[model samples]
Target: MAAKQAERQLVEIFGHAPRDHSSAARTFWQLNACPFIGKECTKFDHTRTICYGTCSVTNAEQEVVICPNRLYENNYEAIRKVGSDVFGDIPFMLFNEYVRIVASGNHQMDCLVALGHNSGKEVKISQLSMDWVIAHIRNQQLVEYVGIEVQSIDITGNYRDAWYAARDMRDSIPASGHGLNWANVHKRLIPQIIRKSLVYSKSLLVKNGLHFIVPEPVYQRFEAIIGANIPLVDRPGKEVIVVHTYDIGPRVEQGRMRRLVLNRELMFDLNEFSKRFISGPNLPPGIALDDKIRSILAVS
Candidate 1:
């Protein structure tokens, strides 16, 4: 199913549905806060007058994370999972903290460190930046780092009406024209991943390849664009790009909100991805140019 809600309903507001109406929900809404990111919601409408804190939406009867920050739930478990996969079970500290530790002559080796906006520094490659850089530190030196990109689906239309309804503590959301921007999969996201993968593949410090963190639905669309038949690698290696997907699992009974559950981790090399890109999406089998011309003439 499309990530777009059939009725543009609000599945989550401030990380909980309007129907929740708990004290925490009320507090978060009143403060215009985002519990996931531990700050005020950054999304605003065209007027920038109010925070539109919708986090996810119902798609195919399941909640799909629409806001990237929502994936920042569970103390960024998704990112930590990737880090552990790349760097093993060592403790990880944000790069800035690691730097401070080094300054204090207490820097520890054989641990994982992350570099990003929150982690102090984000590395840029070929004028483009990955969301995070996770490095493995051994013997107080850089061993290797993995580049990561985090993405969530874009909404095509405003859900301000639903946001307002939710703000009023209503259980129902007004219908809006919002839809998921699936076209972005092939047009923007795929290209960016390809470019970043190319850059990472050539970098000496990047040995573990690039990684993409996306919602399961977005990852599904990605697989469709790249052709589902493409062979997936079993493990991360130099020049391999992995797509990590997460699902906002069904709300537990009487639970305030749904949980972001790690779903699939699919790995593929740049060579394989490029082949699918060059080939492009499949075309109809029975149509002919002459038949199409005749059909157009008939319609005219």
Candidate 2:
């Protein structure tokens, strides 16, 4: 059953289905690129390629190349590490687990995992919404759910320029910042953070919590924004967990590379607003509630 669901999602994203978890993961890796390591380029015919130039830390003498396979492996490893570092060995279930949990209750369901949306239209896969999800069941009924979003410092636009600048500066670049301010947090990262937050705060998806995994610099920038504009106390529908990370090294033997090291974690639970906050109907609009989900929210 889980295999079928996985295949279905794969077909939706790739136009072809995968047979198993390994195949699905491999397909996902092939379809996605590391936002920080290189720039994605498209040819006139619309063929896309990831371009990684010379070693950022070293001079132009040493050409730098990023292996998509390596980047994908590292990205998954980082996400798993963040989960363990923040939640501490808590057993995490895959999307199949979520499906099973919802099925067991015989309740109506409307949930999406690793799916992307843009202004109600299907967009490319959303890296921000692909973390993990858990459904809490009580008395054989679905009660609440939790979702997580992981973020890393990467350039979103003009990848080649940002990549070169970061290499020249030997530091991470922002999603959007002033001229040559590559290290200062880019403008795009903040919006991504807010959109993920709203998936819970404004949407009806996760009722209990929404976690965000980010580097220390990203966390500080996000916190600063929250402090200046939006106070946590005002929002009650969901909780936000910020996982902070640091850079490990540029140890140069053959070439220079860096790994993000996960460190401390902080959270803000909207316990006070959980019950009072407005929630969308149990299922998303236009999606039919079916018996596979127990039909708990089916309209009479």
Candidate 3:
């Protein structure tokens, strides 16, 4: 019963059918078959287009098409789920705790804030690319802003292509790789972490700092590749928390349907994280910089 509820939620969130192992295999095969496998080259242009499409498959009558990119869609849905889970709960953290939820998404970051305000007129500072933001209030006054950025392995072109390629190659004539090579963590996940962290680190309103949510495997890869070697920047007292997730498979319900669970036990404080991981590039001079500097100087 719980599994059924989870599946329903996942379907609502991802707009894809629930896929068991058998169904997934059939879908993979049908989507990867070439449209002109047995046809002569003279009858069809072999070089122009061979496979039906990477994401979907067409029927014999060509009247209907089936899309099998459930895994890809799952990754996207997972990101949004993580964002919703993290930001949606901020308002209920403490009884009578004044909290304002801002800039969340249904399946992606639609509004990475550009100067918004809460009902109480508290300033909400955010970048155009931030994933989500939450503001905390104390004594009827806004005290801190919390930013969140979510990334997935599917963001990398190589990983995405490899995933499809693996499916397509599984039963091809000249069978090659059977699985995704997987993109380098440094190349895919780290860059996003650095980019999002830099944006949050530079924000003047996010006093509580930013959180980056990623899959556990990606986080482990990041730790293995650059453990205890992160570089430092001048953004003192700023924090970039790294949250890793665990895939609890596709059987349970309530945030468990093909969803990744965040490991709250491990957090990477920027003050300490910067001591090892390399810092992102400095922000170029702009009006925002002037304002940030002024705020810092005033606080000091």
Candidate 4:
């Protein structure tokens, strides 16, 4: 089949598993428990560190696949109206850059939005999602990752019910008393998704000796949490991979949106993990200077 041939070609090019082989090849997974209103997202930390939601399976593609919540995240309106088939209408080039980021295995937070499909391609939001997905695919070879723990109580085979566990995890979160930054908290979902991973992501958390910790300014709006990374132990393939969990939020901000987390220690305290993502005041991968931003804008 064409797909098989394409897979072989890609494997030859990158010496990696085919994109469809995530279940068998994935070593790194960045999963997110997002909000239902479509605005906010709660990133479970325990799942990131211990690989709590990790599972077992082979890399063989299944007969019936449930497309992740990604379809829902990209253009909720179009999907709500026309459904998955609508993607067929989107030009392949439109999804090309997105495919690049995912295959590369990392998310550049301060990325610029490029030109529309009409003009020459630029780094658009849609492209960003595709990029992270590709990254998940690329990181599948890391074998260092093992086990996943996020707030989830169910172990049902059906993906439809995964959110039930995720929701329970959300409920376990200690109450907070602060407003949230609309952009910082809400818009951060892409990176969260790009970084978090679990074998079985719950609407809440699933216990596996590891505690599923959540960051602050949290909210949940997603219906079914979709996993981006591939599963290794559950699969019968040999590959090397590792998941990098990052809490890139500022250590602290003085504003009404600041979350008044009742139990500060348990939550993903930003100050504690500040150094993990930021390297010695140097601008990390995706960030650019204000002048650069102005230049990009001018070019746009």
Q: What is the lDDT of residue 114 in candidate 2?
A: 24
Per-residue lDDT of 36-78 in model 3, one digit per residue for the tens?
Answer: 1212221112465443233221122111112212222333343
For every model shown, the clashing-pair count is 0, 12, 5, 62
Give a tens-digit lDDT track for model 2, residues 26-94.
333354423332233211122334433211121122111112122222434544453354344554433
Q: Provide the lDDT at 39 for model 2.
A: 32
Quote the lDDT for 58 in model 4.
15
lDDT of 1 by residue, 86-178 (tens): 878888887767887788877556888888746776777567877888888888888888888999988877667767777786666676556
Q: Who is ahead in TM-score, 2 or 4? A: 2
Alpha carbon lDDT at 194, candidate 1: 90
Please give the lDDT score at residue 66 for candidate 2.
Answer: 17
lDDT of each: 0.79, 0.37, 0.39, 0.24
Give the best candidate by lDDT: 1
Off by over 4 Å in 1: 1-6, 60-62, 253-255, 281-300
Candidate 4, residue 200: how far the Cα is off, in Å:
11
Pairwise lDDT winner, candidates 1 and 3 = 1
Query: Mind giving the per-residue lDDT tens digits that candidate 4 earns over 113-216?
Result: 12222113322343331112111111223112112111111121222122233223333322112222333322454234323332212213212111222222
Candidate 2 vs candidate 3: the lDDT winner is 3
